[model samples]
Target chain A: MTTLAMTGRPLLQVEGLTHRYGSRIGCRDVTFDLWPGEVLGIVGESGSGKTTLLKCLSAQMEPHAGHVVYDTREDGPQDVFALSEPRRRLLMRTDWGIVHQHPVEGLRMKVSAGANVGERLMAVGARHYGEIRGAALDWLGRVEIARDRIDDMPRTFSGGMLQRLQIARNLVSRPRLVFMDEPTGSLDVSVQARLLDLLRGLVADLGLSVIVVTHDLAVARLLAHRLMVMRAGAVVEEGLTDQVLDDPQHPYTQLLVASILHP
Target chain B: MTASPSLSLAGIGKQFTLHVQGGVVLPVLAGVALDVAPGECVALHGPSGSGKSSLLRLVYGNYRAQAGSIAIRHRGQTIDVAAASAQTILKLRRYTLGYVSQFLRVIPRVPAIDVVAEPARAVGMTAAEAERRAERLLSRLRIPERLWSLPPATFSGGEQQRINLARGFVVDYPVLLLDEPTAALDADNRRTVVSLIHEAKARGTALLGIFHDAEVRDQVADRLFAMRPPSMAA
Candidate 1:
């Protein structure tokens, strides 16, 4: 009933989801339902499996057990893994965009900043070079990066600016689901605040649903509608952002909240 | 100021000369001047294309600036960045600085640890010494020990940045110039970067880099300047 509240149907559904990397365990038994236009914050420690869980959900990584079912407007609750690899890739390349923790690592460092943004367009069959270039510039300006720097290498941009460039690169495709891992961590507090404002605006305007991975509950409070607390690769607590952050039942969650002090 | 600068720039200005049908010079930075004292961490804050990176390159000796001068203190001796002896700037970069540009600047197919250790080998350190230094630095930065041998290209975004940090700091250089050390990270990795800056500071290496993150600037920078746009700055 709660998942049905949104008109678009549940965008992504997970149940009994788990993953492991060889002998090391990543996320175990993750279950949730994501709503459209919702911001879901995944928070945990350095070793916690937040990213693994995110990767599984996005089909970037495969889970060892359980199922990640995606509810698309065109289709309904399709098992992401059950689909053919080609189909899964097709679904992801067109609908979902991922922003890695480090923009430079996620991006082609040797290419011009504009090329990095235009890449997604190229992937989705936008072959016209001039059109892609224009779209790239518009997206760059939208993220508030200087248009002139579009020709420069990403190394030329400051850390926060590089993150914004990545955001522009991902958002230019206008994907329905954007996965941002610590989107503002590299940004200054002032710049972070601005970036948060920008992300909030774009998420609303684009009607994008996002799964954000971060370690700060304060950041979750700022941007998330729902918060999931993870420890050692498992979800210990989950609820509305404010509730989980303000009245945490899990000890690990409480410590996380305590550390979330005004920053 | 100390008589010797681990890295120094005076009246430095750089321009990108674009030949569009005809020769026309486009200036990116002008009249930029600063010095990094031993163990000082200086944060450069400017909008993109405000020449923050060009300044880093000039200090790294990637390119020779037509105007002004640059001098870097390597070990006990001063290495003139504007050296008259060479037809190349790459040689100077190899011997003097360990630069971690914003992106993955290492050669492809290089392992994360090797990418960091390569510069040490170029600096005349033994292979064993370089490997040991790289491992120590990566371990200190929270890179999972399992990932050390793997190529950084295979790493996650956060993993690669940790390796980048390790490489930049592995061998003790009198100066370390990073374009943006922690620009793309999640919260935990950001904390890791903040701590690495501390480790570098403790070793008495002069740091000069631009940071857009306020948290990073507040955590390490001894001095912060708000650089005006070049036209407005002049």
Candidate 2:
């Protein structure tokens, strides 16, 4: 296959990335470049190391080998693993976002949705309750959450609403890069579809660079521009989403696509 | 016919290698060439396995072509679809090229109005303007106002096809590809589509389509480009 000649520098680059759980391989030698305003999907069955690769890329877990470089606004390209802990935390709070599969893992259940969103603004040094509340309300509307529900605790929201709230909170800061792990995994089928649509609109509008890990091929198809198919802790296939799904070159990828139960 | 072609293809070839079938190669299209001038409509006429849809997919950059250039006029320059990067293809799809496939593939929960308006909004139309255009098209396509706010997944097959048509025509794309667009539409809706195609052509849009319905094809297509299966051609 010919290499795609992209014009600008990639937003994020992962090279020879590897991670290990004890002696067992979690993910091995995974590498890819993510461009601005692009959604790259990592797909595989359970225990295929999709989440492990995501954890390593998002700075949650240090990889056993290789470099994960991010194009910093101030410092050009810097290795994320080499950044100071404080700097990495600040980067996570300001420039990066991670949406967990379960909303509770990413949200504060006890706080009102407004505060949950406002706290990110405060972290970024946005003062004045009026301004924070106003921004919170605006983001709520964008995510299809009612403004009246701004004061309601997350526990009061449904599974889908909770997910939407989580997205709103993460996006409120306007993070350029977002890492989502099975964003629609826990919701009902109909709810998942709606959230997927909402996410698609937001991603396009914001021009966000996203790394989404999903096992569902349909979700991958809807959200991803490029896809990496993993098996046995290694990337078995990587290509454009339609190409990988429609005419899979790898044997494992062909099986995976063939397994999808189309209606 | 004097105006330069808005879209042109040369020596386009496509073949699928079935990896699971012990590396058997199936050549679908070979040495196919065509052009659609501005304000003109060209229809693909062929049998089922004649690679008509494959040709459209190649032009749209959905499938990579093994050989040849699929050049499209975009932003006053020619872009080779077969060689352009994904980003370039996306930009073309957003501003210059539009496609209407047989089925509507959208997020199942979005309202029919939003589904149609989304592309318009993507091309820099304000929310109100996009929605307004969407409303007009939806009503013109005979999708009732009550059904406009509901997801098309819940609508009948004909209604969904109408929604798909509305979305495709929402943007005045410089070039449009239609794949069996009116397949499931009733006579009234098919007539609406024919008028839409005429309007697009009047606006200097170049259209390439596979119109299975003979009556609709006769009404919209300015010329027919015959295609044959590779086996038959051999």
Candidate 3:
């Protein structure tokens, strides 16, 4: 398949990224560049090593080998693995947001919705209480939550609401790049549509770059500009979302597309 | 005489009065007429500010129309959406009108599976039966079994969306409104939605939708209604 045109400057670059669990290769020799304001979708089945690549890219786990570089707001381009722990933490707090598959995993279930969102702002050094609360309220609304529920704990919120609240928390600080692990995976169809619209709007409005790992091709089709198809710990195909999804060159990709329920 | 379409909008117009600048009137949609036949999927195509979403809201009686009649055939009765009372609208919405919006509004602390089964439970199905259906749909949509029992408070966006889809589709209404139904879905899930749409159509539901993604639009839409911004309208 023809490759997508790499536009602007690369926001995150992964070169020969390989991770393993003893003898099992999680992902091997995975290389890609995510550009500013672009969304890259990594598509593969469970146990296909997509998650491993995402973890490596997000700096949540150390890869066995390979280099992951991120263009920092302060430093021009720095290898993320090379950054000091405090600096990486700072970068994660400021320039990056990670949305896990489970909202509870990413969110503080014990805290009120307002606090969950406000805490991100606090981490970024926003000390004024009123401003923090105001920003939290604003983000809650943006994610389609009732402002009145801001004081409620996440444990009280429903799965969909919790997910929205989680998104609100991650996005309150307007980070430049977001790593989403199946961001829209578990919700109902109608709710999924709304959240997708909200997320698309936010990505556009803020010019945020995103790396979303999903097993669903439709999710990748809607939100991703570029596509990376992985299997057996290696990239099988990588191209523009349309090029790869529509006219897949790889046999595995064809099988994946063919496997979709045509009902 | 031929029966009226399942949904008919004639010369529909809507405008928002700006609060500032001495009530500057902004005409968002005007003189729009469309018909959706039973079992048909009609796509509302437009630019961002073109009022496609507003038109759907108007049909659903969420917005008041200024100029025309928005009518739907429900239980063998023709209800004028423009002139319907709140109670009438509510009654129609309960069983006749189904809307799959972009976002899901869920109750707190509810398990994701239970949330999907709510609509089924509401319509007199036993909790076990409702949950059984919910489980099948959730599994089809690729929601993991482990996450089923847990409250969605922590589920990712896609997982939450699958639950929402299961909920919206559980009722099997005769007329359905979809606003970007597959927007957040991965390819596999999009195909699932396509199949669901086909199933709804086979059951003779009239569908009106907004599809920004051309590929999905091509996959499901039987026809297209081009909506233009007021400034771009001839």
Candidate 4:
């Protein structure tokens, strides 16, 4: 059953995404199709440009060439790279959220939890602090943090709780799509498992689509519907999560799988 | 069951007075005690108000205990964390202890590589030697070489955490105190990190951390400390 890749109209299509850094290889002619409601895992070792691809999709980094087309499930396809600043702001201001492997990247450490969540609302035009704080507390509770800690600095949190705060801060805005980069790269194994369970549970409950960048096959197995393996800045293999994992075709993918020495 | 140097607290306690509204004082942590040993990975499990993190902070020397003692036996010498001199504590932290907080606790604007290498460079390594070592450590942690030259703040959460780990291990501190390192990952990234922790422990770094996940507690923790409610703290 895992081998049956879901077939549907692509929600996000990348065509010839070629990026470079002064003669260095950085994802050459990368192409892929992300369907609606899909959890696509982009897996690769360090320097594989998995993160770069994520940044490009979110319009945080401009691609040297090629185009990213995000087809809003409710609206039509929009070329992300070609978007004007104002349009990009509108999109980011309304429809997108991003989570990083580290908790602080998505969080405003100095601000209260409410402000972190409310910053998104304010960016899209929420004016009142009361409303922002209210929403922030709600999001905090959603992520299972107490309402009282809403005013506490993020530094006071544990790595797991900080990550949860990052999630709350991002997901509070109700964006249709979210970007997850190395989502749990700093946690212990058991904490990783629980956080994974929380994230999968949240994703299912929110009915949100996510693009997760990671280097672990085991992670992709647990949370992703499909997996794309990248090698030297290119998609070396891709298919249903199980297919790519169970019977990897690319030599690099094979080695990557073999490297999974679980105890 | 092996006897590596242990981190222990006997009647370890802390308190602070805060003046609310009209010069009032509040005690944050009171009569807290815990222990960890060389080769021991201990997990502190408690809710937000349970003083779990306060105990970690006390161990890291960020919080000075209003009462009781914080000490660790290292290199055949036991140093009191509360009474250690600034220079002494700085030296101890650099060579013997690694503390990873939830936030980027180090000062900003330092290059990621420099952030990791500063401790090694502090004792005596040349800049070039430190640079080389830093690169190797960050790369092994899977931090992209491209981001190594940038400030840690410029990197993503995961990237920054890798830098923190690199910094912690660059000096090869035998004892590491980590606060909830994997709360943000989706699944795959989380497992990779956990795997790395296991690898580090196998390499002989004793770890004391606060974790929210029972799975994390079971996987890496040799012992678990479940804090009682505030009323039972003393």
DockQ of each: 0.01, 0.32, 0.02, 0.01
Error of 4 at A248 (Å): 1.1
Query: What proportion of the true contacts does each candidate reproduce?
Result: 0.00, 0.33, 0.00, 0.00
TM for candidate 3 is 0.54
lDDT of 3 by residue, B27-104 (tens): 899899999988899999988999988888788876668889978887778888777644356556767788877777
Q: Candidate 2: where are CA atoms >4 Å away? A: A1-8, A109-112, A137-157, B21-24
Model 1: how far residue A151 lies from native, Å? 1.9
Candidate 2 residue lDDT tens string, B177-214? 99999999888889999999999999999999999999
Model 3 chain B is weakest, by summed lDDT over 10 consecutive residues, at B16-25
Measured on C-alpha atoms, candidate 2 has an lDDT of 0.92
Model 4 misses residue B67 by how many Å?
74
lDDT of 3 at B141: 91
Which model scores highest in TM-score?
2
Q: Per-candidate TM vs. native? A: 0.51, 0.91, 0.54, 0.51
Error of 1 at A87 (Å): 2.1
Return the DockQ of model 4. Answer: 0.01
Report the lDDT of model 3 for residue A144: 89
True contacts kept of 2: 0.33
Candidate 4 local accuracy as lDDT?
A: 0.75
lDDT of each: 0.76, 0.92, 0.84, 0.75
